[model samples]
Target: MTHRITVTGRAGGTPGTGRRVRVLAPAAALALGSALLTACGGSSDSGGSTTVTVGSNGNIFDMPLKLADSAGYFRKQGLKVKFVTTTASTGTSALQSGSVQFLNNSPTGFTSALAKKVPEVAIAVSGLGNPLGLVVSKKFAAAHKLAAETPAAQVAQALAGSKGGVSSANTKAEAGLFLKANGVDPGKVKWVTLPSASADKAALSSGQIDWFITSEPIPLQVQNQGDGIVVVDPKKAPMWAAAQAGYGEVVVATKSYLSGHASAAKKFVAAVQEANNYLATHQGDPMVMDVARKVQQGVPDEVLKSSVALVEWPASGSMDAAGWTKTLAFVNSLGALPDGAKVTSENWTNKYLPAGGQS
Candidate 1:
């Protein structure tokens, strides 16, 4: 049986108090004509100087992508990589607009795009499961004399009882599923939508919402502020169950780009594999602290270190069928995906993954 943890509390208030608010409209659908144009914009033939533009959000989930560029892995692969920073939706837009050759986003986001019939496809799996947490304001928890490390049930009870508000990136499916998995019905809780990681951090720090669901790095940053409490750690739950049955962050590309520059894409995956190897070997290295600090900006070293342990970096950066099936099933249960959305093996391919897998 699936376990549900519910937190009951007030619904709406100033930021930092649990409240429900409106989310912005779903990102505008990209026109196929525009997609065709964008897909052809940055293409260069094989052996030519290939400039592959990529975009990603500022989060620890994307560290491999960043590390690839920072460590000159892209150069080693004979491809010129240009990185652009954008929010989840904008990054999707960039991919659709041909502004980027590839996009690093959660598979949940891609699931929405696929449901809409967008032609984008996943090339490689970057990060797995929803390594996320719900951070509540310590000031608010203290003000109410709540216990630290409340279970999902207690937190859901608190939110349901008091009408408190919760906030998260509405564009990603994991945020909503995380709430639902814990028994905080989206309808019952006051929801505020914060798109960017930076914005969510500000909303939390400024006391605009009582609780916010965020992935690693940001949660670590929130804890460093010494004013927020991590009410749930999805990783330590069960069977690495959280990892197996949770959403994934994937590297995606347009069909046109993939068809035209298959080799460069393969090289890109190899570079990420290299970075994952470095992360595994030097799990406690200070370089990770530096990367986390640079990527998250303002998050402390200790919190970043703790978060590192929570993240599971697969050696191959490839998707497993069982994990994908569980993720799709969970999202479907939440109605986050359309009816009959199956995570079949055909939905993914390792054609672009590194040689001999990710080790």
Candidate 2:
């Protein structure tokens, strides 16, 4: 049987942005099946082929996945892989419906999913820490004579007290956690959702919002405009620092999918490890641009370069379980998780990791 899929949305929408969506047509499976289904379900003994679908929101953080595909890592590992470009909601939906075999998303998404009984398991962590910052208009910052690297609490307080000074976050969870952690009451802040990084940038530049919570490159872009200041560096914030002490970005797969395709799954992890190595060494390579172009349209070369500096590509296949536990605790502190919600090291499994891939 064949299936057709359609992809929509701007190439560079943020965490919750619904843009950058693809719809699979009825014949999509047949049309891209051979190319997409390499080593999905077959046995190592018979060299049987397995078809697996992998999804991402197409952000720079997901560059390694794109690099792996372009480098033919999956093919070499004897698996056919289909790349699905989607937003948070859509990607989660695809994973739930079995339209995609695995998902690459933030740890928050996975935590939320597990809390909701979504039956998803995190296999490996890609990147850690927030990798984001709070950007404020230079006019506002200068008028207040705010210092760069101002504490996040001060930034949150400023946004909460400003008239018509709205703050935007990619998702409620992201925005909510940031606010609570920084000592700002979300209820007292005018919080809005801007799905696209570009859209958020526009709002910041136009003074539509007093503050915007976004990852690097975007914050760097605002700095380049000379109209924004980094009032809060999440990397330095204690709450975010504690969260990063837990888990960051992770590779998630359905329990059933991992159980059924063990070898292919291992190969997938191995390929990712190699891609991460490449990214670390060739930080400014054009391949980074190629990956960026596919997901974040209109990403200037400077922004791409800045993003690389902000994101620290992992070198091994192992996850920091202790760090992840700290992250879970931070989430609990923000009331993002239910009381007594516990995340043990057991929530992850290294059995499927390739030899030497274990952290």
Candidate 3:
């Protein structure tokens, strides 16, 4: 499915400012001391709570974990979750170096890190619902006679030779898959690297870029300002709907953490599942807003509300084996997975999830 390339904090939100956050990391590791304690899992400083240093990319994609912290789920599970805001690149290295015990990121990102010989495993499926997509400026869409109901194939053809904005190289690859799925020539679309969130907004506004592939709440932000209309809604697009049927987001951790502290891992997954359940039923609840406001500071409430409407939370905390397989293949096709890396469902486990997580 088409997904936004989350390259930086500004593109998503500031990392490490969440409700219960204790530390923040650069795109590189800033503190290796905590990493060692997390890997050891029995540090005296942890008191009675198991300290799990979790890394996040500082986007709304990490909302559930933040929600869990806000809702007291982590405390209920007797876990002290230490969140580290970092890019997937830095987070993966942190994971390998024992700086963090868990990471919340796209499955593709996890797999790419896995192929690089990082001993990590997918523990649970985060929210999905094809939240990643591309948007065309309303002006551009109107000029080209592109309507929301226009067939994707027709729209793809109209986008030929158009300048498109993306957050990262992986997202550019995702954009290619999206265009090809809609019967467009990926080679014909000129992709400009707009890694900064402000740059993307300005590019789209000044006609410097005709369209951009992004995830919420940028899509919602664009629509709220009446600057753009979503041309490819991953949730509504038939191609994306089919391709991402059983996939969305993943929570991963180093195999070493799971093996050394299995109980803590289970508690962490349970806490995530608890938060996921709360989100499934309370999208518009004030609790959601409270957490959103804290983690996604500076984002407009209207935009956050719009994003909640567009995103989907998983019904249960489970990860489907087949879906994981499909996700690996897709990432492999993108040439993101390293060669000689063995791919298997063994890389994920449902043992830690609540009942019904296994499929």
- TM-score, each model? 0.74, 0.75, 0.82
TM-score, cand. 2 vs. native: 0.75
Q: Top TM-score: which candidate number?
A: 3
Shift of residue 298 alpha carbon in model 2, Å: 1.1
- What Cα-based lDDT does every candidate model obtain? 0.67, 0.68, 0.74
On residues 1-359, what C-alpha lDDT tens digit does candidate 2 reach at each position? Answer: 35555766567677555322233343555546554443343323246545578888777668778888888877687766778886756877778777787788877677777777777777776765666666778777876767676766766677675432323333344555667777887777666566576777888778777767766667766876686877665565644542444555778888877776777778888888788888878877888667766656666777677676566677775765676777776566545565566656656777667778775
Error of 2 at 321 (Å): 3.7
lDDT of 2: 0.68
Off by over 4 Å in 1: 1-49, 143-156, 168-209, 236-242, 342-346
Candidate 3: residue 57 Cα off by (Å): 0.8
Q: Rank by lDDT, descending?
A: 3, 2, 1
Model 2 alpha-carbon miss at residue 271, Å: 0.6
Which has the higher lDDT value, candidate number 2 or candidate number 3?
3
Cα deviation of 53 in candidate 1 (Å)?
Answer: 1.0
- In candidate 2 the C-alpha lDDT for residue 237 amounts to 61
Best by lDDT: 3
Clashes of each: 50, 40, 1
Residue-level lDDT for 140 in candidate 3: 82
